[model samples]
Target: MCTLLWQWFSEVELNSGELYLYHNSGTARRAINSNKIFGIGTPRYHFFNNLFWTESWWGNLCSDPPNWIGDYNVYVRRGESPLWDTQKNQAQAAGIDLHGRWAEGEISPYRDADEEDFRLMEKSPALDAGADAARLDGSPAGNTMACLFGIRLLRYGPGGSGRGPRRRDPGRLRARALRWPARE
Candidate 1:
């Protein structure tokens, strides 16, 4: 069983402003049991431009939070009907991932997940399928730096002004070059 985000509070804390933003991330599991992508937890969360792949019915277990918002994410489930995915449908019905998409036939969006090459394919739906991330925080989503597997990459905001190459591809890596730094 693999879980991504799990949060639990001993006491209820309403409107604590504990906002968590999960953007351009990927989570996958090979198990076929009832696995949870997100555990029941407090704190509002925003999910955007992510890829979730699982082989269980309980792909996402935390969708009851009123303040939790999600959009422009991809969901892939093994052996599930292409027309409908229960977890994605439930999230959409609850107004969480209104713009989320489901990958048919459990097709992986990554180039080679087995080898841990998470780069998106050339025709991947995740390419340019992301909404402007600024909408989540009402601030310009510029100058954001992400570290993937210890490789640091830069993401430019509006007008393509920042560091490194200008690529707006969605998902965590954003199709940037992977630099391996020497371990100390």
Candidate 2:
């Protein structure tokens, strides 16, 4: 978040009264956003992927949530919202609707692929890597290790610390734990 903010501050000229003062976004905020360093991209408009990511003239959080919740304690409070949400929602409630230039999915940072690129993905070998038709119907043809590993990788990604209360592994599958045999 700091990277983005710093980038904004550097790019956008602030006047004397508008000198960027670091302060919480609320009346009783204990502290400002979390100290997380949000990696920010350079100032450029990319229509394909980064279309939705842009800043407003008078910096708004909903436009870009600074802390991602860790830094914004209001989000943790009862019925309270993150400052970003508060900025957006309050503006909305006050009948001042703000709309971005691009919708969520349309404008992308990645280059807009031409017709050939779209066609190529369909003919890509990776999509056709399954074993000969026999295995498609659920019969065991071989280990198909690559496919199994890919599936597992997508499904069971480690979210947090590997060592702690929330640890998990392949052996501790939900079904296996439920069907575990009673103590002998």
Candidate 3:
């Protein structure tokens, strides 16, 4: 599943199933699940260009260890003592939120979140803040806006491919391409 531009008003939790270790009576065996967030499911989940903010002191953002990959996200907490460290440590271990920024006043990435407008403003931290999508799962880089636009243009404009547009070069994400990692 490809998720983008999502805003979570409450805490977010991820399930990674369970893990088991097997070893021989006298031999050593190593079991590693580097790219499996669930430890038993396909590595097909991705999150990008999302914002998370909460006013409660206990609100948190979490994800299962290992597997899941993401970037270009934001997390903010509003309280006397914000537990930003906990949020940062957890995400870093999961290869996600590598470039995610933290803020207190800039809670929303849109011009005005209360007005139901998710469009990023010129000075919004998320305007050009995103990671390379292909690195996560062979997806295009950038925020949800660029992604949605690319999809629409590729599918219904010029020569519609139905399956999505194909080109000699897949090209990198545009518009909100600021700080995007160089294409490989």
Candidate 4:
């Protein structure tokens, strides 16, 4: 789950382990067997860039809501509602992913996720959709910009243009929580 990329056509289940960069056509479910993290009232799960066709069901009915970090992602469902419908209010209340959106099929960020080409297309909603992590710090050192794994690195500055690939580890993910501005 470090810097690689993919798209899925099935459900992603996180029963009692960690998953990264995997795609699933079904709901991502987590069992409620009383893990230390869940028992203590906070779950430190991190989900990024992955797509889901259904709700990220957490621990059936008995388990408490999960505390996870999710951002810079898209969620869409056909017909009446999305996978997160049942947990919509709860999830939002807990701030699961205030940044995610109910994207339409045509607005999908990927050029063709069905064909496994996950690159963001022109006018993609996902362009710069991630949290502006580098801007959190107010000092000169904190003024740096970052382009995380898999996404095209675009640098804009005086007489400057640079691009590269970078992976985000837990150490790098511990910065202050910030929300992306709302889109029109």
Best by lDDT: 1
Residue 101 lDDT in candidate 4: 55
Q: Give candidates' CA RMSD values in order.
A: 12.5, 22.1, 16.3, 13.7
Off by over 4 Å in 4: 1-42, 48-62, 78-82, 136-172, 175-184
Candidate 3 residue 138 C-alpha distance from true site, Å? 8.7
Candidate 2: where are CA atoms >4 Å away?
1-52, 55-57, 60-82, 98-184
Clash totals for all models, in order? 1, 9, 0, 4
What ranking emerges by lDDT with the best candidate at the front?
1, 4, 3, 2
Task: List model 2 lDDT by residue over 30-142, tens digit each.
Answer: 22322322333211111110111222212423333342111101111212324444454643443322221111223322222443232213322222221231222334454
Question: Per-residue lDDT tens digits of candidate 3, residues 1-184?
Answer: 2122123312344323221111100101111224322223323233355544444212212233444344565544544344456655766765655766655674444566668675555555444445444453355654443332121233445675444323222123322322322233
- Give the per-residue lDDT of model 1 (tens digit) for 50-143: 6566553233344442335456666666565433455556566767667766666637767897899987766565665655534443444563
Evaluate model 2: give its lDDT: 0.24
Q: TM-score for all predictions?
A: 0.52, 0.16, 0.41, 0.45
Candidate 4 total steric clashes: 4
Residue pairs that clash (backbone atoms under 3 angstroms), model 1? 24-172
Using TM-score as the measure, name the better of candidate 2 and candidate 3. Answer: 3
**Per-residue lDDT for 10 in model 2?**
74
Task: Point out where model 1 deviates above 4 Å.
Answer: 1-17, 29-40, 56-67, 81-84, 134-184
